[model samples]
Target chain A: MSDTLRPNSSDDNQGAQPLYVPIKRRSFFMYAGATAGATALLLTGCKDDDDSSIDAKTTVDVGVGDVGVLNYAYALEQLEAAFYAEVLKGGYFTGLAPAAAERQIFADIALHEQIHADFFKTALAGNAIKALTPNFSAINFGDRTSVLTSARAFEDLGVAAYNGAGRFITDPKFLVVAGKIVSVEARHAAIIRDLITPNSFVANDVIDFSTTSATARQERSKLPAEVLAVANTFLAESSKVSAKSLV
Target chain B: MKLLSLLDRLSTADAPAAAAPRRDLLHRLGQAGARAAVAALPLAAALPAQAAPTDTTLDAILLLLKLEDMLVALYTQALASPALAGAAQAAVRPDFERMLRHQQGHAQFYRTTLLTAGLTPPAAPRFDFSGRRNNAGNPELFPNVLNDYNAFLQLAQQLEDASASIYLNQVAAFATDRQLRDVVLRTQLVEARHASHVRTLRRTATASVAVKSWPSNADVVPSPAVVVPSPAGASTPPVSIYSFEANEVQLVSATTAVPFLAVLTGATAVQFVALSEAFDEPLPTAQANALLNIFG
Candidate 1:
């Protein structure tokens, strides 16, 4: 493992080069073998922190390389899944008509996020990060406006995170996998935005719209460090995640 | 040596003009020297062995440009059509305009990248929205596509979904250029947003079209409602734009699956649909080009 993993640090410099040390093939296989099948590896890897001194306050650093990218996605998916799960449990969602479009949307999105979180956890296996507890106290889930606004932010953040992290992924297959999931997140972002304000699916805030240059119409992407800064605000101090090595 | 040769072929075959302007454009794009900048990257060094005959970065950019050009035409024509004069259609006109602008921006981005790399992008083809392939004699696979609002929305949904999938399929071709790959990924998400918006419009426009914001097995697949004429000796059969999108199994490698069964237990029918909708599948290049050919 790399020694760059740190706790509760703020490193948001995009100009800084990544401090990445690729995991050796031999060591990867060794870890895989020692953990029996790869499925148990992720569970054990996440479970190891249970008895360790690392508590909720310890900032979990998403390590470097492809593993770092996977963990980064895993962390975001976990946050999203937890948020939607909380929303489903809250008064607003429960208060909606059982057959309401908003109710179905929330239920479907909750399942999608859970599946995404589970997929990453399975794919990362030994490289998976421990589940982080979300801090959504700022979001009043009892109110429709507050819940939808926070949902938009999380979905948009998830899309930008995946878009920005693609450059850090070395494996072509991992890039493909990230490509698969980011689009769904973008879909989620569009619908959530539309639900808040109709026909506002592709807004100027989330997408660059420059009159001088047509090529700048790409979606605004956020580096891992920048994303984590906002994400940490919605996460508990102990469950806050960092990607220092990723930068 | 291989990188140099590929660059040489690109410059000679595509751009016979003076190299000074190309170098200037590259410098302005933060790539000081196209040849030197590309050669210095690790991905560029490995491209010779990894790239297939048709898998060049240039090919990926050109394909994306074509896709975007088609979308730009689709939106421009639809917005100008008299069929969209209704209150419902007028309300969503701005959404189509926004989508058009993004497609134009994306197309411009690819065109500039090719020029910066000392290549000439192919000219935009004349698009026929009726699916008659710019010929009156051809069968219309999508009748009233531009005349009927519901039909227009259906075609729009399919095109957006197909474009997103095509972008997903071509990510590897841009591996040699990280900046290009990043743009492609961002644009791919934008395409997904367009797809989701269109699906929303379709769902709201009618109760018969059951679709979600994201691709789902439970959603009704949009069809042209006409038999597509296949090219002679074509190996692959004509497939819907949404074909194979319902696949539940996701492969991380050739041998290793994602093991969704083991991970997501208690296989309820709804959960199974969620599993498919969780990950968007990539459309193969041949299938994508075939769809594009119908509207050419």
Candidate 2:
């Protein structure tokens, strides 16, 4: 049993080995086995952190790789979904223009966010992090101005987050999924912006000035850290998402 | 030997036959030099292989650049039209100018990218929005795209919507290059915004216009522009721009059709329009290219 557990000491004695043998093959398998073992340990070590019973004050590390980015997205979706769900429950705020249009758009947007949140939840399955609790105490759900303004902020932040995180995603399918979802977020962003101020959908504030063309402008992209910093302000201590591993 | 091995690895997966013709691929390699190929191996591994037969980076970039160039020309012509700057549409001239600037900027960006890739960017084609192909002999499809503001808005809405779909079509092909994918996706959404804004402009201009911020089933609504009658000896009837957008069914995956009405938790047939509006479908590459040929 002791010999079985020990490293192959004989294999390390290069002088005794045949000179014509391929050394690279043995080393490759040895590294592959070590990596597989480390990966298993890393995954298991983070399982408890993903539990639903996570304390509100706990700092949750959205672990690296595809799962990490999806969770990061999940957290934002959860926040937006919760916000819209609450807004719909309370009814449209006063002073909302074209009341019927606003109500319908808001309802549709709320459903879209909820669907996005649920989709990520299903995709991550057992690896998904705890449901984030958004702290919207400061936002007045009764006022159309406040609610729409908050929606704009959330939609813009969501767009920026997805745009910024695109480069970090390693899987092509995951990136395609992100692309599918991000455009919806963008459409939502445009609608919310236009609702707030007509024709200001892609205003310079949210879009960076174009250096490539004198007249062309591009939408702004935010790094994970910058986005999370803004996002955490609306999230409670326990539900705060950390993308340190992702970056 | 290492270079030969590198070539072998790259070709094996994609070769049509054991000894596939690779003149273009080999020419690219020859131009890149042997040292660059050696350096590019690790980077090449990061590029996601696409299954589409013609979705090469050069093709995607060239197509996108052409689309942008067409847009720049369209907007420039619209802004230049004395009718647009007159009293009837005077208030919206600044907005049209803004749109023109964005298209010009987009066109410039695409040109720079092509040049940076060491490819010669195609020259701007003489665009005839009248759809007469600059030849009086050909029948006109869009007769009032530039002179009439309402007609202009309708055409603008169609172009912007088409732009969004075209970008969506090409975006997946860029998956291999993270930087390019990022740029494409970011730019794609801006097109979406532009589409929405154009739709709003149309709706505002005509209270009865059946358009929405997002595309609805009403996408099938007949357009005032683009009356393409089949010529005397034509085989296939030309597809109208509005007809292209009025699609309800969409593919959520390669094989799965999104059950829009079933999955959409709402009431009545009107809500089906909302379901359609909820997702924009991608237009196929061949169709998109065909549409691009109309203005030039």
Candidate 3:
């Protein structure tokens, strides 16, 4: 533990005097995206060094039938909650110009995602998915713009994730419930994107004009694995998780 | 004229009040309700109404069509008001216009039925968004809307939520008419989406805004065991028409005007920035007429 062996503060320093700051920041964000994309490869099977001790081969069952859908929701909530928890951990990207506004928003989303996670946990009870860890080394938690843009991506994806998965729930009641929550997710997505750029939230890309149903104005969805990959980047190693397929 | 004096009498009430519209809404809905169940009532001849109640099936369709027309008219007028300004003004205009078009489409669809039934459809009026169809010289309809973005948005939200609730009830109560039922459901979903969009717009205009959309997880149907007895059906029923967005907007508005929002299942319900987050019930045609009377 000599001073020479100690990690140098300057090595991690970014933003100023760092010719490589922008490149590193860009690469870091893409890292989260990359991790998400490579999750199937990473998660093909568990590694022995699992620190959180959250195992898929273990006894935590997400539920049977509709419970699977709830468990799926619980899984996503865990990822969202973990992301927000980490964002607010250091009080939201220090030294950013919109730090205060962004932190408040971060705090709100953190609370919401956490609440959503808890709602499914309670609703599913024993059938709920176990907590998952998130990996954030790809995110420059220290960089505000990257974090917010990353946030916009996550929020948009969360809304889409919930919406695309709506029809999968077999129970009529559960489907309606999914509708209610998905709309809210849409609202959160819209707000976050609006903050990033005004009027960018509810675009035709997000709403389906071809839909015949009055309430069917939501965006088309991507695969669950795809959405999870985007979410995985935000998950740190400590937040590993898994849930039964609700769909 | 009495309605005018009634409104004048309440001149001392709060500047931005929704109570007047709420009461008028009841009368309007009462007419629609009566008209909807007209066929069921053997005493249709005894009751005086602008339009006679035909049969329950057509009654509901006609009422729904009327509601859609009114919604279109109200939205058009609100957006047209000289009082609205800036982005708040711009944001609502397109939505209002789209809604007007939708309402017209609904009207046309129902008009086909009315025509086949040997009845003439009601004529739609020119919209006065300024809320000034009253007081020939008073240009104060939708007063302080544009410059006062909150007022404008609150009104916008009020209309959207009202439309959402009405659509919800229509979807549940009128499951008998297959074609109409399908149309109602389709339009109802759009109404909810429209409501969601308006809510987001309202929140965005105000800096203190939070989630405008409801969670994607709340149940639309009340479970069979928990299902409240609805007038729509005669026997005890199971939860079939569940709406997931119930978490965002409650069904309590079904029982009365000024629908109250429920707390989210979580200890902390979702947050929204507004003068008041509760639903501002729609004034049915009768009720809207009542408000219009107040100005006369």
Candidate 4:
């Protein structure tokens, strides 16, 4: 997966040719919007045959607009997929989840995350960010306590991230798509939390008890900046997904 | 947060023909005969919630309030039940207690929001956990839901699952007000998590319970053998709360069902279960309201 990131050789090639390049994330959306169909055609066309060349961009920017948000999700899914894949490869926390059924659950979750990652990739054909390299140095794959705790953190973060980003979504269809995926993420979060501690699924820490009304059960949300602050600890700087303008 | 975004991808990836099939649901909403059993009050005497729900945003908020009300009632009854509270298993008590508190919190949020909006929050309806609507004359649709732990869990799972789908169905309605949309969407995931934990608890207790953390076509709950009427003697077909839940097919467009078998690469036929598990199907407002009537 890490091999998917390669330096852009096209930059050197484009230096010889006078090409129109987007200097700001906002400009990318403007250009894409002005020639919506053509922009889609270019993105799809570029990925179909010259995916390697396109993937070689040193830093893949999840551009602005709904497309940027989709790319942002695609980037996160890539990291999650890699993390679970590594977990399974490392024997699924050994004695912690030695049972065949427990391993199967992890495998199924891995597939779900991979499908999520792949869905975003296909949806954002050319605009999808490069596959992220996960730094799992902080995680102890062999220890059940360590692995499950990290899984809980990642799942809860994924849930909060989607909730915070929903307002920025413009297209109704896109909002529907996000709703579908986030529920599944919430499900994953619950199960992982339960595995860590039977009914610790909706603890006060993850949900806000202090709403305008004291009794409202508002699930806590993290802005992109806050989510990335934690998510970036595991993501290499080169592949960091910037949600600076997501709102 | 991320859950809402995942729903976006799930709609695009799973529901290929989402916008069209829902027309059938819209048609059914007109036919869902029974009105919410709130007392008739003149506008001058009280601000009735239903008087001017012409605005979708207002309508969504009201519906959400009712939904949260139903949950709070269900959990309140369950926690009060001697069967559950007196069980040998002490761990389950706090779970329901915490759950009840959360529902109360959600109900308070909606109720206060409605009051602040200058509309009177609808009076809370009486709930019968047995699905008999507290009428001694009616046969029980759900037997011993509050008394039987397993039965309580089954109902809990269904309500939570339906809660998640119902919120997803209303997301578009709250588009006009982003703050309300955020609250609804955020609360929506909390419900899904609640559903997951309940399902997990059920799974731990019963070897026969075949459910995952998320909804799936494989986890089919057999339809009850009997159909019962509400207190007002409104006899209806067995509720379809769990019927549409096991659906594997999702629409991508008005007319297109994304061929999951064809498009998803390297996945075997069995992985299709994972596909359905990966995305939850939304429940229409009429069907949701119909199901919510079961507890009233």
Interface RMSDs of the predictions, in order, are 3.4, 5.2, 8.4, 6.6
lDDT of 1 by residue, A1-247 (tens): 4333222223323211121223442244235436446424422333233312222234677776998899999999999988998999899999999878788788889888888888889888877888898888899989999999999999999998987788898877678778988889999999999999988888999988885553288888889989999999998877878775687
**How do all the candidates rank in terms of TM-score, highest first?**
1, 4, 2, 3
Task: Write candidate 2's Cα lDDT for A16-64 as tens digits.
Answer: 1221133442343234336756434333322332222222235455767
Which docking band does candidate 1 fall into?
A: acceptable
Among all windows of ten consecutive residues in candidate 2 chain A, which has the lowest summed lDDT? Answer: A1-10
Tell me candidate 2's fraction of native contacts, as a decimal between 0 and 1. Answer: 0.34
Best by lDDT: 1
TM-score of 3: 0.51
Candidate order by decreasing DockQ: 1, 4, 2, 3
What's the number of clashes in each of the models? 2, 3, 58, 38
- Model 2: per-residue Cα lDDT at residue B21: 29
Model 2 CAPRI rating: incorrect
lDDT score of residue A2 within candidate 3: 14
| lDDT string, candidate 2, B1-296, tens digits | 34444434554444343342233333232232433322233222332122232445556677888888888888888888854766877777777677677777777777776554334577999988888899999987776778787777778878887888778767655655566677787888888888877776776674447566766655436464443322221476755544544555444334444453443343222244544455555555666777788887
Against the hidden reference, what TM-scores do the models get? 0.80, 0.74, 0.51, 0.75
Per-residue alpha-carbon lDDT of model 3 for A41-92, expressed as tens digits? 3232222222112233222334446676677667777776666667765534
Could you give the fnat of all candidates in order? 0.80, 0.34, 0.06, 0.66
